[model samples]
Target: MAEFSNSNTVIVAAGENLPLTETAVKAPACIVHREGSGLVTLRGLTSGQCRARFKVSFGGNIAIPTGGTVGPISVALAVGGEPLTSATAIVTPAAVENYFNVFVAAFIEVPRGCCVTVAVKNTSTQAVSIANSNLIVERVA
Candidate 1:
């Protein structure tokens, strides 16, 4: 299992995407973690013999525009820059609340040498001030 986190001080503006910039746990070379990109690559897995489970999360206060309706802010796992829509979480901020947390988890199997990348995308309309974040990847089979 491997883990990564951020400085808890990164602010994500609307229409901007940023990667969490810290590697807290060092795993096997097959894990292939990239610095600053926040992308963890899992390779060398034989089909039907290996399964990887990963989760990504971020928590903070959201700033919603005044008089504007709530919008869906989504977080998902991206494999090679393509997001897996089936495993995603969306959170909408209302005027009654300011703090929010978004996360998504997926268990998947890949063929040998297939590069799988992981990151978080704030697919929403509100600006987020991320206070803390984490990503954990583990091999299940």
Candidate 2:
């Protein structure tokens, strides 16, 4: 079995989409973290079934306009730029004591040297703050 994991506590701005990189998250030895990129290189593996998991903890502060709406925070898993799965949650106003969390899990066929990435996106008009996030990948064959 092969496995890799990373975590981030940095704040992600509103309306921003970022790929979680290995350098930024400091993944363990089984996974090679790319510098300045969201992709994590899976090493010592061949074509097989792999499972990926993404989790994001985020919140924001904004006064919704009379007829405006807040947003749905989203987290996604992708392999070589192709989206495998995604999870989304509604974010409530900061004053309302609402914090949003999203988790996504996907099973995909990963070829040797394939790149796996986890991404977070804030679709709200107001800036949303991310408290922390985590990603885990495991080879199950």
Candidate 3:
């Protein structure tokens, strides 16, 4: 007999500060695992701090319940490759000087072979661009 195992995270892209309303904007599928540990790190470079908007939404048209740690969303901002935070809000790609850091922790339960969509938006009026962003998923031994 053979044991079974699986896990993965798809890289999503947002072009030219645009809203992802097209079929091409669909994010890759994430494998579902009964148990595992993982983390996702998003890094985008810009001229200054911009209020970067990001969301971890359910794959496809399926809607997940809100107000739960699972599938929760987060945002982080950095300036000159350094971190900065305000009393109430952290800096973001939208807020150049305030670069914010947001983490959702291990709060989501992804079904095997299923993918979660992570969308990042630049809400600032200034011209800002996304440099690099990546996601990772791992299975614990």
Candidate 4:
């Protein structure tokens, strides 16, 4: 039987459009997202099945209109700047001012030395606030 391993969890509090200008610092266990760009890059991963999970809590003060998009939050898993799987959640009129959590998971192929990143973006007219956000990656194989 093969032993399974999990990577360290990376977290970001503020949920904003990550800048595409800078790269995050490299780490052996886990990589943290950049200040402007909400992306975490991991290196030296094995090529196999890996599970990625993300959770985000967000809310706004303004009431969301019926059928109107208040806040749209998107999380994605990418390798070499290409997205493999992505999930998006939007705040509806019923979820205004309340903290909502968005969870996404997927099994993907992680290539060795390939930069793996978790990114978040918010596309809403109103100002959105994120209370907490986190990402976890585990090697199932």
Best by lDDT: 1
Displacement of residue 61 (Cα, Å) in model 1 is: 7.2
Candidate 3, residues 1-115, lDDT tens digits: the string is: 1111111221222121112222323222222212221222222222243322223321111111122122212222222222223211112332222222333212223333333
> For model 4, what is the error of residue 119's alpha carbon versus the real structure, in angstroms, after optimal superposition?
1.4
Runs in model 4 deviating more than 4 A are 1-37, 47-86, 123-126
Comparison by lDDT, 2 against 4, better one = 2
- Highest-TM-score candidate: 1
Candidate 4's C-alpha lDDT?
Answer: 0.40
**Local error of candidate 4 at 42, Å?**
2.3
Q: Go through the candidates in order and give each one's C-alpha lDDT.
A: 0.60, 0.44, 0.24, 0.40
Q: Quick one: ranking by lDDT, best first?
A: 1, 2, 4, 3
Q: For model 2, how does the per-residue alpha-carbon lDDT over 1-141 read when each residue is reduced to its tens digit?
A: 222223444444555554453333344444565443455555435435343332223222222332334544443454554444444444455342245555556554445554444434545555554444445555444
Task: Look at candidate 2 and tell me the lDDT of residue 104.
Answer: 57
Model 3, runs deviating above 4 Å: 1-89, 92-106, 111-116, 120-127, 139-141
Clashing pairs in 2: none
- Model 2 misplaced stretches (Cα beyond 4 Å): 1-9, 13-30, 35-37, 47-69, 85-97, 113-127
Write candidate 1's Cα lDDT for 88-108 as tens digits: 566676662355766567775
The stretch of ten residues in a row with the least summed lDDT in candidate 3 is 1-10
Give the residue spans of candidate 1 off by over 4 A.
Answer: 13-17, 45-70, 125-127
Candidate 4 Cα deviation (angstroms), residue 7 = 20
